[model samples]
Target chain A: MNAPTIKPFGECGFIAQIEGFSSDVDSGLFANAVARALRSNDGVDDAVAGIDSVAMRFDPAHLGVDDAREMLLDATNNTPRNTARAKSKTIDIPICYGGEYGPDFDALCTQLKITADALIKLHSTAPYRVITLGFAPGFVYLGELPEDLTAPRLKTPRLRVEAGSVGIAGHYTGVYSLPSPGGWRIIGRTPLALFDGRETHPFIFEPGDEVRFNAITPEAFGAIRRAQK
Target chain B: MMAIATIDRPGLQTTIQDAGRRGARHLGVPQSGAADRVCLAFANAAVGNRWDAPALECTMTGPALSFEMDIGFALSGADMGALLNDEPVGRYQTISARPGDRLALGAAQAGARAYIAFAGGMAGFAFFDSVSTYMPAGLGGLEGRALRTGDTIGSRKATMMAPVDIPDTLRPHFGHDWILRATEGPDTESFNPKTVRHFFSAPFKAGRRGDRMGLRLIGAEMISEDARAMKSSAVFPGTVQCPPDGAPILLGPDAQTVGGYRRIAQVIDADLPLIGQIRPGDRIWFRRIKAQTARQTTLQRQILIASFVSDFSLR
Candidate 1:
């Protein structure tokens, strides 16, 4: 693994950028490890993992900027480069595709020139890895979508996208954990709650977690949604 | 808990806010809080409350509220031409009200936001250890949303300290022209030297699309030398991100945890509150400063504030 270059992020934080790091499962796991290690230290306010970088915010009152940079460097150097040993879980998501739940479904199928069944088969057959969680609380970014499954985002984003809405853009698929304005092409909807602050673990997916989507009927979606409530 | 006031008019966008939600950005939560922390602290201090006590944050327009019980409140930030019982009231000092008294504020005469702090602190829904409202996710505050007409505001009871006045030297001033001190961002090298130099030299105007999320700056197009799409990375309040269109978006308190735009500069921590007071058509200039200087300035400002509000830290 290439060593990350440390740079000052504003006056109270440092961001470690790993050059030539791909947005893949292994890189995400390594970044997550480094962020976790940094967060454990005193004076670290927040340690967040990006696609190929780890940014840490520190309290300057407790630690100087130079000391914070050193701490970030030490955490990066000490974290294991090979993240295969990292413990991650596989989560299965049941999705209701097409019709009302997916407003852009027919348009996307026509744009991609694929039959509904073919598209669903391609999307569900392959397993994906969580690259990161961001944009909003519990919003999970899963990556390496099948090339044929990729689609450009909407020109004008919808003002309100319901929570659990599944969307595709460029090389990745993401789940909107909360109702928010989004531009991604809608493909499906999930019944499971992706975020619940009441729970000890608020997020459903973490970096490097394996994710598999399974097709389900609208009735099943309603049933699962009711069960969760 | 008891109802203190009833919202007569909700105004443009009034929401409950505090210091903000911290230590949850790693979970993709934005630090939703008072857009102007300095003013929030001052308002709270004037009412003899903790610096982080929950308060009402009114946008360009202020709300009309009627008190249901005797209460003490203070106002800070934008001069909103507040009136109590149809009589003009002063700001930065505590004002007592009796039951049935009405408090109303007009459109801001200067800044964009104003804060109203209650004597015993306002009550709101807490999420991630803060009452600050993050409207996008509908978390925190009163049902995690902005105040509306007919909403009854609640308050927490506590042994109150005598109301005090904030020193004039400690109060912040707002104007149409804003000069913000900043440091280089993580992606500052992505732009050419000429564009980087132009960023410092040029003056930009705040666009009408300003909100708690961010403010769009309209000025010279700052096209990046590297046209490759940037990977999503950690972003915070005050990160100046430039998109493909070259328009810079200055992130605010409600900025996303990660973004995919090219970042060229980061407004220093000390100057972040100024971003809150920026109104549409406001002229802004970014002044480059060393990281050490930014740190020193923040420390000095924090010391001054701490002397007035004990245990208050700007960071």
Candidate 2:
């Protein structure tokens, strides 16, 4: 594809947009190319790769915006078409579906006019891509759940969503790394810790990684949680 | 006595902050740091510590800390009517404290946050190579949360130094109203030119719900041209996002790494210190400038900050 247009994100930031990634069909390849290039560029201190574009944040103290813009533009022009895919790990998250762990399971199934078993099967079957990470540390935003399973956010958010709670909103599914107030519809909960600062790698998943969910008995979930302690 | 101190009373939301976790934005980590870097640096410098040294960033209400050893400390930022062992102390100056000395801070008569710096900085565990506290995800500082009463914080090393005060001319002016400079949009085109114009000229009051996450403004709604939800994009501390409902949410230091709303403008780095002082009900005004001008202003501010070496010249 052609080089993306570079725009000023803020005074010290720049966004390189690869337009129409939503329908481009090979948007992931383009996004990965930009993310890899910008991350390795010394002028750019941090780069966040979104679904279709990349935002580069720079320190004006060391690198001026003009210089940063040039380096980013140059990087995009040299998009490595033959570059290998970024290193990724496929993590299998053990989840307890449709019970006390999923407070809104019955309500969600009823609203969507689907059977609990069907909903779980559909959700567990697809491998979701990690689009962009944000909202909280290690909070993975996996996307494009089959159109049949897309759901709107709760009108009012829950006061506290337990850590490990797996939920869906719009076309995205995410796991809460910490207990925080959120509006997504909870479908299940995971026994594995998504984030732990003490670990060599704090986050279990990174952007561009693939994730699959596996249903487990609540008793198994309890055993895993206990062992994690 | 060893190099240690006890929190007699942890007022409001006091937490330890440093320069913040860097180079981790791609991992969705917020750049959690002192709300007012300028003041934090001033406090640290006064006590002969590095600019990014870990220190207590006390909110509107301040904490009451009692030392367990002789220590050198400095208080900066808002005027909190501080006291040392019941004797009134001052802001922007380093004071030597005895083992039993108590450093107490009263309600902020001006500004919204206060910073306290100890010599050699506070001893704390690091998450992602920084001691700055990110409360949302529970990382960094003391157990990744705000300070509490009965908390005992230690220091690896302490130094005894003579008192030094920042000159009045160099001190930041904290008040009920503030004028902040900004650079218009990564998403300004999504907004009507008229609304963008209004945004720069309108008077907005800081809403009560604001925290380190963001400052919600109430006044002169900024409407977008299409009002459609945009794809989630990168956002930083100073990003001013205009949601569909038209109200602007000016992000703060603890803001999420990305957002989907239309980010109409970004507050300049030079005037970011004013962000920490913006209290609920404070009147706010924005002035738009070119990206080049914002960089120039920040450079100028950096030069001024560097000149603050005067406070440490006596050492």
Candidate 3:
């Protein structure tokens, strides 16, 4: 008997999506479940999932879309959500707030009506969840920020937002690892570069991981950067 | 012999590219490389360059690059009206550019991207296992940025090499007469039959917003009646993503590693190079084919390449 819960995803790349859960809860369960479901399928070239859906790319040269969809459905229904299988890693990033290190730090303080010290404490208080990543290379999008800290992007994007600069856009927050044009509200700069193109494993953070930002004095930031180097 | 030119005026988008970096998609980094793959390949062939060898990919037109060293080079893809020191150089062919000679590329006369190939090879910097440059991440090429006015590029040392003797049979002088083949996607049936028919039947124009990431094909809007949201997943080059807006976005070099949009069709691998050559205002149409046929075509091309490489490798 075939497992019967899989459904059709859009046909662009021959993807069949497995039903999933919310990003906030049981995300590990979802990621493992999705990966498990598509692991053994010959038709599936790759499998990636969001909080609510798991998408698979089917190589038609290998199998038809209908067959691929059926295969994914069978896999999802047969396999159980393995939450305990995956462990979340928490990384502490030390950032230098103001001065030449962060160009938009002062502007952010004025806009949010919060002192730098208070912002740091609140930011560090909670473990930010990793959301989806898409804007640029090795860019990780994290969390719904603290309620008061939520802010829109600049009307005109800065020509160059230095890499490792921490930024916020609405409820979403992220860090720029590469120098690219972006419209996020810049709050602080992290001297640590997060993305490197040449390395085999160039990315530090993936979606669904937890992260905490620890504010450090310029001296500490410099010390960490040097140590990493 | 190997040679390179000095930039007098860098055109809109001039960068050195090879096949681009692979396996960086999981991290949201797109594999960026030659925007016009077919023409880039032809130019490489004209000068006996390797398929994945580094070459100058000039966008729109190109900067007036002066020869820093004497070398033979070939230009292909969109005719950029490329000239050497005020004299018109041959298209789909290699010519000599001596030191101090300026290679001027003017407005596009045919296509958007033009490739400049060196005989010995190109001077390259490494990124993601390849020399292809991704501009956004500031990786590859001269500091991961476009070539600028007054910038100097070192030419390949061709002391042991000579100007490649190109065969006239390999030349693709004008555009058109080429048909792109496509295969059904993993999500082919997700869209209603009408939308799928509209895609294969209708003719589309390459939009002005086209970039290395993807081409925004302008034509009938293909809407997915199913309002269900899609999960982010791995996307490949030439994946035809149909947004709710109804237009098809042809993912290209430098495209996102993953996307959440519904994909309707994937341009076959053989046809991806054709898409790269398509510039703004260029006309194109799609035809769906079975995977078997597509695979056969790819295999045929591979056999041809293997035979040529064995007999007369660019190296």
Candidate 4:
């Protein structure tokens, strides 16, 4: 693995980009470990883990930028033992695919030259990791959506994609926890409230969590929604 | 209930804000707080409240409120033609309200957001350790949303202090043209020399899409040498991201924690409050400064704010 490059991001932040990562799995684990380390590290204000980089904000008053950089370098070299991938949570979510719930179902299948049933089976079978949540609040980016499912984002994004809209962009899948403008191809929807500020755990998927989708019928989806209410 | 005031006119996206939640970006939380933090802190300080105390953040339009009980308040940031009991009220100065007194804030004639801070801090649900409202996720503030008509904000009881006046020199002025200082961004190398030159030299107009999330700017099309898809990285307020279309988007306080666009520069911390006051159609010019110089500027601003707070006891 190539050594990570720790560089200044803004005036008060530093990002460590781990280039030439051995594999997606290894990078995910490393990123999560680094993020957890920086989050708890004294003097660090904020920390976010990307695919192969970790961005950290610091209070220059408490710790100078040069000192923070050195601390980050030290943390990167020594990954904490307690934050192993095994400590991550596995969450199974129920999704209603195709029909009215998925606007781009037929179009996506036609473009990929795959049967609808086959597509659903392939998507539901894989266990995806919670890579990051960058775009919006509670929005979780889970990946690596079987390379076969890799697709480009829409040329023109929709003005408003409703909350719980499950979308696939590039090699990842994500759930829009809130209504937002997005370019990802929507393939399904979930009934579960992925984000609720009132709850102790506002977001269902945290970084490092493993997620798998369970295909459900429209009736089942409605039943689950009713039960929650 | 310690009802202090009832919102008669909710105004445009008025909400309670504090210092905001820290060390939560990994949870996809943006530092959602006052757009112009300097003003918020100033208003809070004038009323003898902690710097991070919850305060009302009025948007382009201001709200009309009726006091349930006597209270002390301060108006700062945008001059939204504030009036108390039909009498014109000045900015940067604390004003005392009597029971049943009506306070009104009109449409912004100058800047974008205005801050109205009460003597005692506002009582709102503390989500993720802050009262600052994060609108997109419906988190923090009153019921995790913006203030609406009929909402009666409660206040903590405290000894009333005499109103204090902030010096004119300390007050920020809203102008048509703004100059923001910035430092180099991570993706600055991705842009060609010509684009970099245009970024610093050309003046950009704040587009219609300006909001708490980001301010989209229209200016000289900045072309980058590498059009390859860049990996998403951490983004913060003041980050000037240039998408494939070459238009720049200046991230605001409510911006996404991370993004994929290439950032050429970041507005310096000291100048961020100025960006928050920017309104659509305003002209913006970026001035490049060294990272060391930017740090120094932030330190100076911190000292200035500290001095102001230190004088609070004397006042």
Candidate 5:
């Protein structure tokens, strides 16, 4: 479901209005420019660039909201950004599609106008770059899927989307790395835990990493889960 | 050194907290720390612990706590009729407790969040560098949820902590007067002058759904400028996001990493705890403060906290 449209946000901490599309090029360029500016800016922290908008945080204690906003304004408008490949990554995620693991497996097939077999092939064929990580921790949004595959989110969010459930919303496919309420059309599940608190790097995938998902069988998934435990 | 407090009866959303994950935004994690930070700091000071150490962050109604070891503790913020073994344990003052003494709190007489601090910080395993519980990821503080009956936590004697010397005159007392300061926002222009005036003039209520993420305030329906199809963007703590429904949601410690909604204002850093103490049905007014003033105040506050450690002896 689409959130109702409204006025633009904030004045100083970030830019007010900017037009950028969802196309790979538009999204990529906007993200890159914002990221570059944030990297260059001395005042900002937790600087994040999205598909069309960029948001950065600073200790309002050090960089006043006015200064923070102005800094972002300069980055978005005055500073020219480099349009280059995001830090490339080849993260391999082992998944279990269809059957019980993917409760929405059959649902995705019906919605996408394709069979289960074709759906998996379409998804696995592409190498998706990380669009953004928001909503929840370790939740990775990857996409630019086939247009026919695009659809709105569920009118009602599911009560519980198990960790590792892969979903699609508005041409974007995402994997839930934690258990939480979600609305995407889940098409598969991954056995390998995407989140590792024990890892030196807790976040398995970053905003700029490149990713390719590999499918696995349910039995193999069970064995992997057992071995990890 | 372990001091135990048995939960006689657990109330709503009481959990362990401290200075939450300080630098987790790079990993898309919202810092889920103490809701009312000022009170937590004072409570820590009262109990002879570091200001950043973990403590029990209790919401409106908290559980009846019974101590199982000889220890000292204090409660700061929100008078909830707290008592030890049916006798009152003074607010903002250190109180000694014996093993098996029951401590209880009733309805809040003032604020929303109350801090229960011990001589030592909350005894819990660390996650991402702090013990603040981020419930979404199930990290930190006793399985990342509320404290329940039979939950036992240990504490170590504070090594560097000194008895807080704040005078009673400076302590917060229940009052009806409060004015919050906010910094300018990118969307300030979008709001008509009349609407801006209304925002400052009207009294608003913190919605019932308020939590660590953000408190949803029910006020005048704010209209976005010319109706724009806002693209999804990054948001931060203290961001005041106005959804199309016209309601204002002020982001807090656990605010989202990104949002597609329009933002109207960002609360100045110094006055954030003001929002934290705002309870449902409480009224508040806003004033615009220059960022420079806010930055200066932030430094002053930090210096004030830094001055409390008794071991400020030359290294």
Candidate 6:
């Protein structure tokens, strides 16, 4: 792999970008590893991993800009280019597809020219890994959605997308862990809570976690939702 | 904790904010703190409280409250025209109030936000060890939301200190014109040289859609050379992002951790506080500076403010 390009993002922040790297599983793992290494360093405030870049913010009082830049360069060099797949856990999510839970279901079905059952099968059959958590707390971006399931985001985003709303846009599928304004096209809704601030772990999914969705009836979704509450 | 005051009128959007949650951005949590850290620290310092202590951050308008106990407090940031018991009081100085004293503040005369710090610092729900309110996630602050009428304001333990008056020279001056020193971004190459040059030279007006999250700038459209939608990347406070629509949005302390917009420049740490005080229609001009110069300015400002507020570092 070519050396990553390191540039100053702000006065105290630096971004080490891996150019020519596609948003694939391997790239996510590599970017996440670099971020983890950067975060463990002293004086580093935050080291967030993007799809193909790792942005790091450090304390200028403790670490100079040159030192921060060196650290970023070192992170890219030290991090194994061919990182061995670490032990990851696969979690199952129960989803109720098509209907009130998915506002864009009909439009998406018409656009894709597929039956509702075929679309559901295409979405749930493939297992996706968490690329990166962003935009909101516990919001996990699962990648490489089946080509048939990929859809464009809504032109005008919804004012409030309920928590656990399963959305698809481009080649990524994500769960709206919090009720927030979102532009992703919703096709299903999960009954499980993705984020619980009071808990020790807080988030259900982390980077590299494998996720598989299990289609359920609306009645089961209601039952699981009530039981959890 | 004891109830220190009863909120008679909650301002337009008043919430308890501290230094904000750190080390959580990787998990998608924003650094939602006092938009203007300088003012927050100054208010806390005047009352002899820790610089990062939780305080009420009032936006646009200020709140009215009746004290239930004697307490020492100070107001900083925007001049909200605060009055104690119908008597106008000055800002940036510690003021003592007796039980049953009512304090009211009107709309801001200048600037956009104000900070009210109590003697013992306000008590608020802690999330990730910070009480800064993040309304979107409904985390931290009082019940994870803004203050409302009839809500009781609680305090830790009151510790009265010798009244300290912040000198006029040390206090930050607020105005309609703001010049934010910035460094070119990690994605600066995404835009052509002409667009980048136009961005720095042209003056932009803060649009009406301004909030703690971000401020949209209305000016010359900054068209990116590469029209393809960029992948989502890490964005921080002071990141100037240009969407496909050509408008630029200046991210704030409460902005999302990552976004897909093309970043043009990032405001330096020293000038980040100015972004918090910017109001709609305020004239904003971005001054280009190198990262080394940005660091030097931050250090100079930190040293100047540290003389009055001990242990204060503008990081």
| Candidate 5 lDDT by residue in tens digits, A1-229 | 1121222233234433445353753454556466655765565556665566566665543666666666666666653433435456688877788887777778878876798878888888787877777677777778677666787778777857888888888778888887766788887888777777767677677665767878888888899889888
What is the docking quality class of candidate 4? medium
The ten-residue window of minimal lDDT in model 6 chain B covers B157-166
- Model 5 complex DockQ against the native: 0.40
TM-score of each candidate structure, all chains considered together: 0.97, 0.94, 0.78, 0.93, 0.86, 0.96
Expressed as tens digits, the lDDT of each residue in B175-266 for candidate 4 is: 88999999888888888877897899899999987888899999898767887887778898899999888789999888888788888998
Candidate 6 lDDT over residue span A139-226, tens digit each: 8889889988888889998877888999999899999887777899999899998887777677888888889999999999999999
**lDDT per residue, candidate 3, B51-97, as tens digits?**
56678888877778778676777887777777777888887667876
lDDT of 1 at B43: 93
Sort every candidate by TM-score, greatest first.
Answer: 1, 6, 2, 4, 5, 3
Residues forming the 10-long window of minimal summed lDDT in candidate 1 chain A:
A19-28
Comparison by DockQ, 1 against 5, better one: 1
What tens-digit string does per-residue lDDT give for candidate 6 at B51-118?
Answer: 88899999999999999998889999999999999999988888998899999988986799999999
Query: Which 10 consecutive residues of model 1 chain B have the lowest summed lDDT?
Result: B156-165
The runs of at least 3 residues in candidate 2 whose Cα sits more than 4 Å from the true structure, single-residue gaps closed, are A22-29, A80-87, B1-3, B158-165, B309-315
**Each candidate: chain B TM-score:** 0.98, 0.95, 0.89, 0.95, 0.91, 0.98
Task: Sort the candidates on lDDT, descending order.
Answer: 1, 6, 4, 2, 5, 3
Where model 1 places Cα greater than 4 Å from the true spot, the runs are A20-23, A84-87
Model 6 error, position B156 (Å)? 2.1
Candidate 4 chain A: worst-modelled 10 consecutive residues by lDDT: A79-88
lDDT-best of 4 and 5: 4
Candidate 5 CAPRI classification by DockQ: acceptable
Question: Which residue runs does candidate 6 get wrong by more than 4 Å?
Answer: A20-23, B158-163
Estimate, for each residue in B106-157, the C-alpha lDDT of model 5 and write its tens digit.
8785687788888767677676788887666677887877888888877855
Model 5 TM-score (2 dp): 0.86
Residue B82 lDDT in model 2?
94
**Who is ahead in TM-score, 2 or 6?**
6
Q: Model 3's chain B TM-score?
A: 0.89
